[model samples]
Target: MRLRRSPAAVAAAVAALVVALAGTLTGCGTGERAAADGGNERFTLRIGVIGSGNRLTGPVGYLHDRNALVPLLAEAGVADITVHTFPNGPDLNQALVAGELDLATYGDTPALVARGAGQPTRLIAQAQVGMDAGIVAKKQGGPRSLQELAGRRIATQTGSYMHRYLLGALSDAKVTPKEIVHIYSSDVEAALERGDVDAAAVPAANVEALRAKGYPVIDSLAEDHPAYRGTSATVVTDAFLEARPGFVKVWQAAQVEATRRAKANWDDYLSFAVKVGGFPPEIVRRTTLAEQLPDTPFTEEGLTLLEGTKRFLVEQGFVRRDFAIDDWIAPGARG
Candidate 1:
């Protein structure tokens, strides 16, 4: 839950850049929200979760399982919590724009793309960073590098961090994107085992399952590539941010508290994830429980990673326009 900061000198420079980018975050607002209904008024906090459900490792997972946010939001007069799941980031962003979500958790690429497209939202905090994707192939024999996988059938969950990782890895190795086989995460191991695809770039949690089946693992984005290391953040639509500042702060505090509790009960938390995620317990324990979960105020490293993601999205035509990372984040958050 500790966020790594940039060196002081670099932080100072980036701080200046943030101040410059803050204003462009939202193109236009619908004007100020109407006054809240009285203290007794009950309102639901709608949250968009990217992925079927994490309910085990992230801030949302911790908060959701305990029904913690419901009480926390009560402090600010919000009464209920509703979590909606999306298979991927792009789909989640669509729901947000349609006014179905007030807050969301998703990868930086789709968030940036949504913001660049004029979605009035701000990244209030980060829940994950430096996550690595595993590239696994059939056990018999497989390519050693991304370059060798060129023109080969590569599998991944489309519109996920794994998808972006595969793209960045291939690009870094000077291999162009071509003939990718998109599939669900659960099917990755089967795809690799049966030679349905020469290789699959999947979330780390899925790697152990493949390895258990004797699939040969080739590379990890964390070890071999820095720029594409994955990240997921907590964001709030501008409408929510403007209408209930206290609610947002309370929500952020709940996330931090959830992180604290999750860290304290690490093993139990992993076990809980296994049930909610329907994956192998060992996979959840090894891949997510061992991985660091982050809390608010953001981090300098996250900003750098986000900048790289934005560049990649824009370059690949995923994002229709350019937007400043600083402006995309919560104005109050320093990172």
Candidate 2:
């Protein structure tokens, strides 16, 4: 679903792309497509992700668990599909700006940031909203409460929804972004281990790992604080959505199927979670059981969260331009 290539390879491929391939992508309603008349359209749906392991209740995990993305994209006339992983949302946003990805599943913060910066991308669907997130720190000398982090260095992947949540978490305690140092989640764990950063905002997956390593978890949105909620979304380039009218619907179907499967077969879900989240079975069992984590659904709450995130990012100067969140959602694509 993302980057890197040789110039010759890029040019020859772009020169070779047929109108039929183009037709299918734009959902031009042009019928079976000219290229398909001879054979199937040659198309690749590139996806971007922010995880080394596909976990949590998002597109990456659902696709990984069911092996459903390829066949689903194929049904929509795509032949090749790639799922590219990035270290964080900011990195993924770079790929999107360079036009390296056709679609990306990332938090609302990065997606909004990309859009605010003039990336021609549209929110196709909500992957998740209100995912469990929290701040964890080294137990040895870490702060006991959010207030203690006021004058300390706290880290999170920069430009992430979690970063926004960290800002809000601090704001709730009357703390400001200037009070904490921002670092990447990739390096933050090491920083915490070295006692360099006093605390970090992490996904539910890592909270247990840090706690197990004797880090104290100062706060977790698992209890569902308004701004602390996580919002992961399915975004496609504006060009991609224009070409495939109901492409987002197909993706949504895969989400529904994946969620149903996880709920129906919990033991399997736990096994997948353990591997992806890098937590022990007991922790995965307790932390991410079906009851603890809700399935990702497009709803009023998700829309509310999306709107709030956009406004917050602009207010904080995280995104330079202001954009209507609704303008970013694809035509007929639900929240």
Candidate 3:
């Protein structure tokens, strides 16, 4: 599908331009100085995530729901924590660029887009890797394969990892759609039922439920297109890292703990995912197990996947420019 910029997209471009200019004037040296001067300051860490309300899925959500992050963050002098949710990653990026969110945990696409647009953020962790996207077709008269999608309308949440997967998968299949509509995840089912679109690219977590409801799965990033699989990125603004110099180490420790607990108590973690993610238990189990959470903040495999994601975004023109993933990663992130 050809890319079109809506009014919201134009506004985002303007915001990105402003951020880029600001970064050019101030540079990284100021942030480094702040880090050295304010190593022990206490503050409230505001985090933006992609989800419904304040609920999230996976290991991060597990820790938040269990109230496990507070103590770990306390070690870094974080007095409080606030979580804000956006419908998609681009919205979360807007919050990050606006300085409303000190940290963000979301899909890799928008995070890379933000970084490429000169948003001062650091990659602190790969919360999950090898995430999958699914393409689901209508129950009746739906396309049977990716090739059948040509000349047909497709729908997906814009700026989502699923959106990236849809574009890549279609490109690989050498299929061009009639149109690609931007729909929210909550509205995808209704749109499909109304025949508003031929097929929809959805998160893997929703594929099983949709299939149970009679939607046909045409293609999946996990099974059919592993190269286009998504990853969840945990990023913090350079300003935030500067102000709380020890934050990355503490946050990494918290992530390690979360991953450990999630694996150790698998059933309890599944129950927690079902409660907060609002997906069926079976779907949650299948999807959660597929998301490979790292014991460390960053793994070699995860970083390689992240680098590939950034490369794809840049090549596809989703990101404005290219950047080295190594330079974007924060100190202490690998641990």
Task: Report the number of the highest-TM-score candidate.
Answer: 3
lDDT of each: 0.68, 0.66, 0.79
Give candidate 1 regions above 4 Å deviation: 1-40, 53-57, 139-144, 289-291
Highest lDDT, which number? 3
TM-score, per-candidate, Cα-based = 0.83, 0.80, 0.91
Report how far residue 39 has shifted in candidate 2, in Å. Answer: 12
Per-residue lDDT of model 1, residues 35-139, tens digit only: 344323567767788656533346557666777657766876677677788776766766676556778887776677667666668888777878777888766
Clash pairs, candidate 3, are: none
Clashes per prediction?
0, 7, 0
Tens-digit lDDT track of model 3 for 1-335: 65543323633573555556566323443344345546566667778888877765677678878887777788887777888998777777766765677788888888887787777789998889888879999877889899999999898988778888988899899999999888887788898899998999998877778889999999988999887778889998777776776778888888888899899888998899889878888888888873478787887777787888788878877777688998899976664
Task: List, residue by residue over 133-184, the lDDT tens digit for candidate 2.
Answer: 7789876777888778766777776677777787777777786432355566
Question: Which scores greater on lDDT, model 1 or model 3?
Answer: 3
- Winner of 1 and 2 under TM-score: 1
The residue pairs that clash in candidate 2, if any, are 1-46, 1-47, 1-82, 1-83, 25-243, 26-243, 27-243
Better of 2 and 3 by lDDT: 3
